[model samples]
Target: MADASLFEVDTDELRRVGNTMVGIGDDVAEVARTAPMDGRGEWGHQGLAGAGDRFGARYRYLIEQLAEDVDRGGVSLRGSANAYEEMDAINAASIAGLGMDW
Candidate 1:
């Protein structure tokens, strides 16, 4: 159902929304990857953006929230950076693959 919506929305708009979401996610991932354990939450763009259309505006929050939880002792950071990087790479590719003219 969700994937269907992603493919069905107005392409230009969805591309814009998706690209922005991915950018935010990427930025959070980079910051979280290098951030000190305590400073990880500073990169809160994703969580802060989690109120709107989730997949549209709140998509990045999933990544941000994870970083926050990890910093709060909810998860280990040993391989966190790799995970975040993978997420960014995957999302960026998805956005670019759309070949949005905008």
Candidate 2:
């Protein structure tokens, strides 16, 4: 089997990536909320205008969903990093209680 020791967690990188994800999500949400839907009025035909409105509404909905998903992922990533740190601390305390030294 490959050495498990080769696997390592880069908590700082995880946090940075999480922050970036959150920022991107916020930006996307802002754009989705502010984007003009009035362009549908410019369509020449009534059918085209209605289709455009439907498409625009669906696009906004999808964007909102994406923003929510990304925000949740960012929170999970950051929380995972913190959990890792807490686990390490508990492990250290256990080792000390057992009179072990690293």
* Highest lDDT scorer: 2
Compared with the true structure, all predictions reach lDDT values of: 0.46, 0.77
| Alpha-carbon lDDT of model 2 | 0.77
lDDT for 41 (candidate 1): 36
Q: Worst lDDT window (10 residues) for model 2?
A: 1-10
Shift in Å, residue 76, candidate 1: 27
Per residue, candidate 2 scores C-alpha lDDT tens digits across 36-86 of 567777778999898878878898999999999999899888887787766
The Cα error of candidate 2 at residue 20, in Å, is: 1.0
**Candidate 1 Cα outliers beyond 4 Å, as residue runs:** 1-9, 37-102
Clashing pairs in 1: 46-61
How high a TM-score does candidate 1 get?
A: 0.28
The TM-scores, one per candidate, come to 0.28, 0.83
